[model samples]
Target: MIEEQGIIIALDGEFAEVRTQRRSACGGCVANGACGTSLIERLFGRRVTQLRALNEVRAGVGERVLVGISEAGLLSAALAVYLVPILGLVLGALVGTWMNGLLLNRSLDGSMADLPSVIGGLIGFLLALLWLRGYSAGSSKRPEHQVVILQRLH
Candidate 1:
């Protein structure tokens, strides 16, 4: 399981929004003076990321608590998040390459080598963007008071 400490920002029935504290590795690093990370941190300060989770316990806003998700669940979620776009990209690339090869009058060596990659890359990028947008849109449609609880961490 992956665990982290977060402060509850909002409680919507069984779901809670928590913000995790951002940590800086630059302050204790030996290359603090030369690292771009340190420079960015100095310019922007620390950043915090907030995520929503299904609350199994009776946690309230402003309460500090430990949150955890199982490794299997995390992996599955990550795969769903990444695989859709990647698959779209691959499909786009293949289709683009095939179309380019068929439409261009040039020889196989010339057309296949040149236009296919460019068209494929463009199609892949656009498809990936669309997939990401759709995925994000679905996240907001989660039901109120319904949460998936994997486990609680101390």
Candidate 2:
């Protein structure tokens, strides 16, 4: 499980809204000066993340708590969020190129020969986004995807 300390800012029934400051692993890394993430952090600064967690401990507002989510759950969510769209884009571009080869005998110079590729890529990306929206809606209700309050902190 991945755990973090946060303060409960509000409560709603069995859930609590916890606010935690985003921490960077790059903070102590030697490559921090050259890393893109570190540069973005330097530009925008550290951000505070607000998340609704299962208040199984019945923690109240103003209380500090340890929140956790399973590592498997986090990994699956990341894979779904990143990999699916990239696959769609690659597949769509390949399909588009194939179609172009079949439909046009010769590649036209400065013409719309690549139009199919652009259109196909856009279609695939939109389809992936639509699927993700549905997946997120269903996953949001799953216990595995939920972050839970493990214990109240002193």
Reference-based TM-score of each model: 0.61, 0.86
Residue pairs in steric clash, candidate 2? none
Give me the overall lDDT of model 1.
0.70
Model 1, total clashes: 0
lDDT of each: 0.70, 0.88
lDDT of 1 by residue, 33-108 (tens): 6989988888998888787877877777887877766666566557757787677667777877777667875435
Cα lDDT for residue 73, candidate 2: 83
The per-residue C-alpha lDDT of model 1 at residue 11 equals 83
Residue 61 lDDT, candidate 1, scale 0-100: 86
Q: Where is model 1 more than 4 Å wrong at Cα?
A: 24-44, 79-87, 105-113, 132-154
